[model samples]
Target: MNGDIKEDIRSLSLTDLEKFFADQNEKTFRANQVYEWFWKKSCRSINDMTNLSKPVRKILEDHFSFPVLHIEKEYISRDRTVKSTFRLHDRLMIEGVLIPDGNRTTACISSQVGCQLGCTFCATGLFGFKRNLAFTEIFDQVVELTNQSLHHFNVPLSNIVLMGMGEPLLNYEEVKRAILMITSEDGLGMSPQRITLSTVGIPNMIRKLADDHLRIHLAISLHTADNVKRSIIVPLNKKYPLEELRDALKYYHEKTGKRFTLEYLMFANMNDSLSDAHNLAEFCKSFPVKINLIGYNQVPDLDFKRPESGKIIAFKEFLEKKNMIVNIRKSRGEDIEAACGQLALKDRNQREG
Candidate 1:
């Protein structure tokens, strides 16, 4: 790369692209057309912009680079979930999962190369923080996964979840931009209601998201309601405790009038007691929230074990008795390491080691 080379054209917004085209003495409408190709069509090369003149395409190729993620490895589970390990331009790896359930398919995409929040129960945390993915990188996961869903299941992706690899709120700006591109009429034209952003409960950032007034759903990874127990598992909870998170969720619910989901992973002999269920039930009373009881997916080197069926049933019954909405989210693709909390690039980690 040369100092004189232009930046990634995909990084430019429509307004920036318009200015660039204007400076090039080209019609401003060309910018909109090119922007459509970059985002809407997810074109990987300047040559893919067939609507543009050869001279214009040549100019783009000479000035800008379209560094797209290449699928280095793909694993499919018996349950038909697909986990893909993508190699970025610098060869850093990130993972994304395509989860299928009947007619609906969900794309679980990553926002960063690795995770900054070191939740003890998570595999991504084992890698430490690598880098925040570019907005293009985030959007590319959705595009690629959507294609996979259509190809494998003969159905388009019905939902998108920012629940893979990294804490989405940490890469707020890029995630925000990616969401805008994803839901824009000229881009994917997907409904924001179909997207969910999951976080390990970053309080101030959660409040900020409320202020932004986005229509997407939010899911808080609140494995335990007790602050002491929570902090031991999700280390970020020490910074943003349950009280702060409660206030943030209150604000978010009041502002958007949208019900959010609280994700609780049931671990055997760990936060699966009757008292723990009571604490979680009380926590949900603060805001309009649905409880998603998820079974722990075994990760290498982690001592946490999935709770028995009887314990999960007892916990769900307890929440239901409290007049709270609860759904048990079945773990998908665990055999292929594509289940909930299992999106870490384990093969890459082994290779790096």
Candidate 2:
């Protein structure tokens, strides 16, 4: 943070705000009012706190800044999926998506500017790591997408998936804080159950998330069950292999007593074979889990192709035959590059220019 840059007011806790008001010889309740405007009301500017006196607003304006992530550009797919390029205060860019299904809409938000986990199938990995988004930045994505949902689909955002750019567990602290704010009564008031954090199975961090017991859904991006194949695609697998990941997931289940989701992005002729399906089934035996067989969105220069429709059905049937809960998740927003593994910042040079 530069000295010239005023601190983000949302970074202060309720207690910190209350203390600040008391120090200014103001009523402590003013902090509660400001806090409500910050989170519950989603106020973008201090002047939007209409309930506050002008003098109080002046005090806030003088001390702290209310910077917001503004949309630089947005694209709508044929299926009504909206992909937005959000410009951060520092001029860094990130992406978010709003997918409308019937009456329900899901907002997929990014946790980091770019991903360090170099998954070969994901475009975000190609851009390389930049920085973790502040908790406020993460929360702002949801607010903006919620507005988009109402504007486009005439429905409120029903769910949130941290399945956008970077791995959530890699940026644990800020991600956790953002989740807390999103689910808290003082904030958006969305249910914890409505949120899902997708990650590439960081072993120790998985254990940490399990112990913390955040109560949100966990979805692992386990494209393949075979370690050698997994390592080739998801380079992080070479460091924390499938065995360790399995143990960590087992611990998560034992600790939380929750069934997590395994997201399998089916690649044609690679991990879509019957043997690979058998390996995936065997891997699921240790813990209670549901499987989401996702259709891979074709990224430019990425050789990984979507499996044939028949192969995808066969894979889903194989799991169903073994009494597993399975769903073939339809890839949305491929045209706008908002589907899974496709959220690399395409407007970087444009924003920089």
Candidate 3:
């Protein structure tokens, strides 16, 4: 095939690859060998598959192309957190983070270049949406972050979170494919329990996730329980109100029988009051849930301020009094703009210049 007509080899499934080899009068096992190189070995080029014959490798190179992501720039925080800006084949960019704590290292990967949801407090949405990432692009982020962890912290990546730059559920198929490859025995071989997909609460997608029964964790970014305030903070809330979201989550629990996580970003005098805690407890009543009260990471031009420590403590105490599980997640990598709600492209002008 000509370069103009060639497609990404990673886009093909095993069955498709097997058939392609057979059509070329090659042994079908060549597909198996090549598949292992692609997923299990994480080979960047067909030339890297040493087990394949030179003729076979030449044929593969002629027929297919493997798109690879390059690490354009990296920033390391004082806390030892690493943020990477990946340059795609088309020259577009996205960010991923490596967060290390004690014995565990988590790779926070993105599902899209930029976010479509314009959360007032987020920096990614300030640049507007670019495009959804392909499954291979998403997987490449994990591969690089895993390498970063071993090089920097001398430990294997213990967990993976799809909580970096975009609304994951919006890019459904690509995100799902990336997760399957991340957890598949033929791929990274990590356990599904070590992976989490965080969304800003997409009701239909939440129900669809339940039906898929992926067995990975699902997290909803519920900043507030009050609908009026939520709509102002998360603009998507007006379209998918709390009542409908509640019904969808109820259906999810009934189907999967699994506990989900609710992420609440704390902002002073905004949603950190005792009354807000009561509403949150009432919302969690419908299903088994864990609450993560995250400190607000100040983004430039965003007026949201982190709540006082006393107020956050009181709010957590109130939730615990309701017998609810709660954890206060202190902001990590704030100095490097790599914490939650802080991942975005900072050199847009330089890139386009």
Candidate 4:
């Protein structure tokens, strides 16, 4: 550890905080109060903990540091979807979006500064990999977006989607820690059922999540059922493959007894045919799952286009006929580049340049 760098208080667990307080000759209860300030109040600085005595506050200020995100840019779509670009302490940028549909407001947040898995159609992959976000950084995105939903729509956030930029399972440990903080009574206190984690089907990680028995919803990005076609779009599939992914999902279902979700992006003339639908339906038969058929969101320099309405309808009808639950989720915030697979760090780079 660098001698000049103070410890980040947010990184310490409650027990660790208590130990530090004990060493300082302060009561252990002070740890609980500080934890509440760090998590419940989302305080960015020690000065904001006015409830602490001046002497204790001074000591904390000298020994600890809090790193918080600064909102760099915010955009609201005509559909009332809000997207915010946040600048980290190291100046890397990440995005979070608040999407409102009737009574439900979902916060879609990122887990990494940039993405390592170079999915061919994703904008975030264009920037290449930067680093995984700390647990506090992930938790902060939810708190910020929850506040945004309340401020803009006068409604609390009802759902969370780990689908904004990076593959969440790649940052599994920090993401899991952030989820615990979000659902803890001392923190945001949201139910696990309302949270959904979407991944690009990392097989071993999927099995690990099942072994841990986490009840939060899981979504697999399965763009196509054909192994070769899927690998072309999502390169990670080349490593995990379709057979391994299917077995992993089955294991997950058998262990948790929870139905997972399959996210399919329909691209024009690419994977939107009736045959494609039949293949997808057959794949879902391996486990209890629902299909979320998303229309492709155009990214800069990408050749793919959204499937035609007639083609989309035909494909969905085919799946429904096969007794598979299917939903066609419309792309939101397209005008502001806030739709699925559209998140990039270019704005931050341009500003820095």
Candidate 5:
């Protein structure tokens, strides 16, 4: 009999769980207890499941492992931005960051190892694509961050952004499932509104995401408004240019009636001119778009530099004058490569050398 076969704690759904216990000649209620241990109790080890009989606990110990990321290295910036490298089971390195403002706590989790979106200005693009993170792996990030922070601060994490190291839409199924699981009442019990998914403008995934009509915030990495310029900075723009992206945004706004946030990383003397801001405002007229003006966080591998504060203010003012909603995003964690794409633990040049 296959009654003694073990199951991966992270991979099994509630249905597979029932079959697992059934194979063991145990009642279906046994599976629910196991599932709750993962989602509710968040036990450190299988032995911590005291509700389960000793034999069942032994069975679980022989079979399952707590999907976890081992913290290999950590860096904290003077500006209070904290970034850590988590080594997965297969030696894949991913980064998680905690950015704390007075009232807001944002934890950035990586969806994939290296990104396929070779944006010219991104540091991760320099590192070739590796693999996607499983749903449980992503869940592990939230749990670990929560556990770490609970010891330091009183409040739980207030924000979760899929913006650490990879393009989330490329791994849509796992990403979607992870989000659903994270926001599930039985799971993390986090409200959907507290999560945000950032994408590099994959139209197919964008359309599907809109169809899902998830109430969570969707932020688009829109660095440039001109198709030609955008195509150079963001290669995906070739497939979904300004026109197509506008159409997608319009559809998303229409379908969900949810306002989307446009993220613009301003590079000094590159794409932060007065004309760039004007073009940006003109492009976003089709739907309600909130503009977030980000100062390009500098990385040694990338040539792009953050625009001057005066220029950024001028750009924001121009958008406001045109009756567009815009705000300047203050740069955090610049001290220790705290910029979005700068947290690359592995040296790409050294690998190639």
Candidate 6:
């Protein structure tokens, strides 16, 4: 934290904003002006905020920088999925993706450097736990990625997905703050309906998100239904099993009346069998949810492999026979390693190599 160029202003909330203005011997109106620049305009440098006096800008710049990650490497897929790694002030790096569909562009933002969940099939989890991202850093990702791909992305981030590096719910408060900032009209001007947070079934946070009345969609990473197989792949299943997860989803639907999605990744012989698909359909019968069958993107150095095209077709057909509405998701960035579970390159890793 000491070495990182952490700007003090980045940590200020609504109350802290007033405090900072008072501490700087300025009127409270100054705080609101700065908030407009940061939240509304998404300004990075102090010089960009022209409303503030030159003397005031100088004081703020000397005290705090606009904590944002500079773009390090950008990889564009042939299909137009752009994945970029950003280097933070501390030299720590994170990845953000701009996935362009027919008329919509979704920005997949990361909540942390690495993951603590340790899901066996995921490349991000394989890296192990790193600290959660700060609020400023998290916000910077959305703004920066949007600015980077403005020319191409059909929509200005029609959807905001927390399906990147870390387990978003584990970094609860920061994720909550980031969501609030995204949803606030004064800020990113994003509608909550457009945002979807994908989790490996964090029960408590699921119910908490529902309780808070956030209208965002929930996508649960339910790779398997068998407790034994699920535990082997997703370690968090030991804490919150299928039964508990079912109850939580039930509660969430009851509270929000929103239909959640069950994200099942297809891994060759692992969880792509006909019986496994049947188990998944049976598992979700108790809750109101749709199924999004994601075809895995093979990561280098990972043991898990993507299922065959025939296997994907057979599994989707089997689920459909069970009256389940399932859509087989196309892999977005295979050529550039920017697809589902394939964002592993970082500035530190590059430097070390």
Give TM-scores for every candidate, taking all chains together and pairing residue i with residue i.
Answer: 0.97, 0.97, 0.98, 0.97, 0.94, 0.93
The candidate 3 region of ten consecutive residues with least summed lDDT is: 344-353
Residues 1-353 of candidate 1: C-alpha lDDT, one tens digit per residue = 35986688798889998988898898999999999998788898899999999999998888788888887888999999999988888778898999999899999999988898889999888878889999999999898898899899999999999999898998999999999999998899999999999998888899899889778999999999999999999988888899999998998988888899999999999999999999998888868789999989999999999999899999999889988999999999999988887777776553252
RMSD of candidate 2 to the true fold? 1.4
The clash tally of candidate 5 reads: 0
Model 1 quality (TM-score):
0.97
Q: Report clash pairs, candidate 2.
A: none
* lDDT of model number 6: 0.84
Candidate 5: where is the Cα deviation over 4 Å?
A: 1-7, 63-66, 346-353
List runs of model 3 lying over 4 Å from the truth: 1-5, 349-353
Per-residue C-alpha lDDT of model 5 across residues 1-353, encoded as one tens digit per residue: 23765455768888987997888788889888888888776666677788999999887677665556677766788877777778887777888888887756788888988788889888778776888998877888888777656644556788899888889989989888888888888888888899999998887778899898667899999988999999999998898888988888888888899998999999898788899988998898889989998988877757788887999999999899989889888777778776676756654432232
Give the per-residue Cα lDDT of candidate 2 at 259. Answer: 96
Model 4: C-alpha RMSD to truth?
1.3
Q: How accurate is candidate 5 locally (lDDT)?
A: 0.82
Off by over 4 Å in 2: 1-3, 348-353
1-353 per-residue lDDT for model 2 (tens digits): 35778778989999999999999999999989989998999989999999989999899888888889999899999999999999998888999999999999999999998898889998999988878999999999999999999999999999999999898998999999999999999998999999999999999999999998799999999999999999999999999999999999999999999999999999999999889999999999999999999989999978889988999999899889999999999999999989999998775594352
> Could you tell me the lDDT of residue 11 within candidate 6?
74
Question: lDDT of each prediction vs. the true structure?
Answer: 0.90, 0.92, 0.92, 0.90, 0.82, 0.84
Which candidate's lDDT is highest?
2
* CA displacement after TM-score superposition, residue 276 of candidate 1 (Å): 0.4
Q: Please report how far candidate 2 places residue 250 from its true position, in Å.
A: 0.5
Residue-wise lDDT of candidate 3 within 1-353, one digit each (tens)? Answer: 55487899999999999999999999999988989998888888889999999999999888888899988888999999999999998888899999999979999999988898999999998878888999999999999998899999999999999999899999999999998998999999999999999998989999999999899999999999999999999999999999889999999999999999999999999999999999999998989999999989999989999999999999999999999999999778889999999987898652342
